[model samples]
Target chain A: MSLFKNDSDFKMDVLREVGNIGAGNAATALSTLLNKPVDMAVPTVSLLPFEAIAERVGGSEAVVIAIFLRVDGDAPGNMFFIINREPARRILQGLLGFDAAENDNYSELELSALSEIGNILAGSYLTSLADFTGLHMSPTVPSLAVDMAGAILSYGLLQFGTMGDDALLIDTTFLEGQQEAEGHFFLIPDPESFDKLFRALGVPL
Target chain B: MTEGTLIKVGMADLNIADGGAMLRTTGLGSCVGLTLYDPHLKLGGMAHIMLPSSDIAREGQLNIAKYADTAVPELLQRMISKGAVTGRLLAKMAGGAQMFAFMGGTDTMRIGPRNVEATKLALERFEIPLVSEDTGGNYGRTVELNSLTGVFSIRSVQHGVKEI
Candidate 1:
């Protein structure tokens, strides 16, 4: 008996291909921002059952930054850009070169800069994905959070709902000289969204 | 030096110290830290609330210091017991931030915001004026208040060491 009876393997392959392209694009954008040599490892992509997401990234007391994007279609799909808080702060500090001794808190200027950084990263990843898979999507304004993993994933799952039943997660690490950042790229699709993704990838369900 | 009587507020104990009483709590995250003081009476109190509402308390019947709603009232009662009359009390608040980033947007889980909101409401219900506050940001704050001097300070690391 075959483990995957349908076109699931095909879909997974397309996701990995798109993830590789997205990771490359993200690396370029980050390198430009840091004005240094930046390397992003080829993402490790996998298909995750919706129920396992909480267990995979839940309950850790960490801050998170998330960016949501809506893919264009008759029934739109959603993509997420998620990062842990410590990395978010460190990334901002590295990108801005702000001195810690002089400032004891995130100035409004720093918040703006971090938001812009999120926009660039999310935009580049989606743009590359679109180019590779022939799909188009636009993102909402990024939001910041300081909470447990369970809360963050729960919120995303609720908004996107059972759409993530057939989800793909791409995990990658970004390195800029000695500073490093970790990120998660989640591709979620409902039945309708899955149709759009299949159409874009030229795969039949 | 009075050895500064250390009031070890367990999970839900609202402690009020007046004129030579010092109230303190250790290791706080994603909880609201509230300080109410009366400059005239040289009395003050602090409550460390773990959640926003007593209704959600896994342990029924609020202990005051555990949840925001119950804790605020309990703090007030204790302050009153310590001779902090309602009209004379002045409030200064701090904490209530999503200390961990993985929690996501404020709209999703509002413990931090709710705690801040509940504290404000409780103060308003008693007609106490909130003088100054540092709340609703993405950082954990550790605070210390001196009962004798009525001076309070909060220290946290966001980008660096910050005192408010």
Candidate 2:
């Protein structure tokens, strides 16, 4: 709560810029991977309650595929690449040239392929962010899971749980051909990391 | 009455239900969903605990329901106000799964087990017996507790509905 102290609007704008830059590169990576144009919406940064956080993707009980990774370095945080089941199946079938099953169950190979895709997109995102902020941010190996959106996204919020019931998240949505929603990129920096992020970017503390 | 009503409990929250109402918390991963029930009074309480201890809290206004140590007592107090006796209270918990397991990873995200252990320790302070639990897996769970019958049911994506 005090993390914002004041100047929350300005701080949110700064965070929105951060998301814009990071997700821009990720969308570029996805475009290259799929050999098609991928458009990303303007990033939104908000302080959301724990329940509403899951509503961003779908609902608490909505099952989806998520690739999670922990970012460690100057501005440590959690990152997630979440996609709906239909888009995941499409990516597998269209990009990798595999007959992705229509059923709910995903094959091990399909999962790994999706993980690798997340790795590349997240890598591009972090690298660009690190370059922009001049801070060293590295991502752990990505882990993939297909489960309830609340369950998967809640893992990213545990670090923030100690501070308050609400968390600040930078969310960016990706659209394939500017029509079909593909996935979302959520960047939730730890509670303490906001200071470091602000100082690094020369925003007034 | 009619069928039991589902009183949804969000993360970092707790609730008490009675009169055949159901206490439910959804999408619990690396967090514990603890339910305390009094069979005689037909009263039940559920807290979706996110952390193991309140000592780690750095917020200005401490949310007691978010941590195991504080939530257990808070939920008990609420149930007691609803005419439920501590002696008659029994616990049934689920969730607290490791969700994502990495090699040589710190206990950061692996806090599911610690949440369970802390919740158990908190229950010990009241001398309330833990009747059953469905915890410590590598998946997610949505659990519900029936106030009338004290029936704790756990539902997961990997495992279908199972009652404890």
Candidate 3:
């Protein structure tokens, strides 16, 4: 069974627009931080199984650096800011003026810097979403993790786990200039919160 | 296909393997990959348990394999029906990890450790000895069990591969 089983095409479009607005705002914030033009891809909204969600990044065991924050309040949810290693290096070098390390091991300073970056970008994303929906949504303190994408993404699926194996996700990819993707913003609202979201946006659910 | 096939277990799923087949589960974090091996019968069962108990489940239909309390007995019953001796079975598990550290008293934040504890208590109820484990870390792990040898292998990015 799927959450959007009875939803119309118009509803999906509204959700996609929701993703676009939030990510667009976050992209602007990131562009300002790096002093470089940041481009965002059209957001993808999908209801996928746990394994396939990990495949969106790379694979189950693909190592990634991620920042996680739990959204609390009117429309509670889970949010993740994910970045691959290479782009993360570029981000560090560009924003923090530090040489990219030769190895994967990151010092505490680097991790903290990455966490703060995620914090700022996620804050912008949520602020825009709150303004758009007129729902009070706030992100908790951000936490950083350097681990497998599947492991980190699965944390966001725990709420959906109770209902079924598949969870809905709104994912937006951020690009640095015209280069490859630099990061991703994943928003997974709790299942029950979807009703409030649709109602807030005047979309009949 | 060869008898020693590798059978995969997905998240919140479970299965039993024999005839020299290997049982494996991948990308486990905050979920416990609990396995029971009976060397005498060359039988093994694995469960990718996601929650600590089924009592809190509000789902209309319950998935037994998704909860620690339910998955343990279900796996045990599967192994027993496969002609495996319950007295000789040994348990080995991995992949209950606090992937993100959070400062709070929320039960959801402590699910990883709670899963480990619940799995342990479930095994204790059956008097099954937990021979080995690699648990409670801020990382993800993939675990595989060889049915013939009853050797459990744990693989992670931070720590390479270790056999228990």
Model 2 CAPRI quality: high
Kindly report which residue stretches of model 3 are placed more than 4 angstroms away from their true locations once superposed.
B1-4
Worst 10 residues of 3 chain B by lDDT: B101-110
Error of 1 at A65 (Å): 3.7
Candidate 1 has a TM-score of 0.49
lDDT of 2 by residue, A1-205 (tens): 6568889889999999999999999999999998888999999999999899999988999998999999999999999999988888888997779679567777878889999999999999999999999999999999999998888999999888988888899999999985767899999998889999999999999
Please identify model 2 stretches exceeding 4 Å from their true place: B1-3
CAPRI quality level assigned to candidate 3 from its DockQ score: medium
Candidate 1 chain A least-lDDT 10 residues: A157-166
Which candidate tops DockQ?
A: 2
Q: Which tens-of-lDDT digit does each residue in B50-153 have in candidate 2? A: 99999988888999999999999999999899898999999989988888978797878779999999999999999999999999988889999888888999
Question: Model 1, range A1-205, lDDT digits (tens) per residue?
Answer: 1223487777767656766787678778877886767776656656554335534543222444555454444434455666655666666768777642133255677666766776787788778776766766665566544334433443343322212232445556565566545566665543345566667777776
Task: State which candidate, 1 or 3, has the greater TM-score.
Answer: 3
User: Taking the candidates one at a time, how many backbone clashes does each contain?
Assistant: 12, 0, 0
lDDT of 1: 0.60
